[model samples]
Target: ARPCKIVEMSTSKTGKHGHAKVHMVGIDLFTGKKYEDICPSTHNMDVPNVKRVDYQLCNISEDGFLSLLLENGDMREDIKVPEDPSLANEIRSRFDNGDDMLLTVLAAMGDEAVIALKFNTK
Candidate 1:
């Protein structure tokens, strides 16, 4: 499942004694794809367990895999590049240029990887 952020919410009443349906409009946080859903107020939706963590780009393999160093001194080499082509290109470019990079990794539950690179202003 992809991560989603609700941008709008509207409710509609079918009758005097009926359930209220909520119309939710959301945009994909990464892909910027528009998504909309209508459901009862009592309906439960799946929310992705996401966390933001800092990672350092240690290396890049010939196959284009990123080797990241976590805050706890553990190495993670399986993170895929983010879906945004421009962001992905920027990340690689910064790594190649030997920039001081502090990557904001969006760790989503079990599969954790979305790179938001922040570089030193100097």
Candidate 2:
């Protein structure tokens, strides 16, 4: 299951013979897509385990793979720049200008992506 950020959630009062209903609107964390669901208030929903890590941007390959420096002095290359052209261009431009960059990567359900970037403070 993909991880989503709940944009809106509300509960409707129960009727005489029915359980309360919950209406939820969520945006996919990785894809920027919207999803809506209505369920009984008593129902259990599956929540994906999501992790975020900040990595030092070291290099970007020609085909878009990112070379990130791990905290423990290791390099990881599985994630790529985000699909948004503006973000990708900003990342590349900053790196090309020799600015130290820190990239925030979000991982969930075996999927990972670079979600944000900022200058490295150190």
Best-fitting candidate, scored by TM-score: 2
Clashing pairs counted in every model: 0, 0
- Candidate 2 lDDT over 1-122, as tens digits, reads 56899999999999899999999999999899999999999999998899999999999999999999999999999888889788999999999999999999989888898889988988
CA shift at 6, candidate 1, in angstroms?
0.6
Model 2 scores a C-alpha lDDT of 0.92
Best candidate according to lDDT = 2
Every model's TM-score = 0.83, 0.94
Evaluate model 2: give its TM-score: 0.94
Model 1 spans > 4 angstroms off: 14-17, 120-122
Clash pairs, candidate 2, are: none
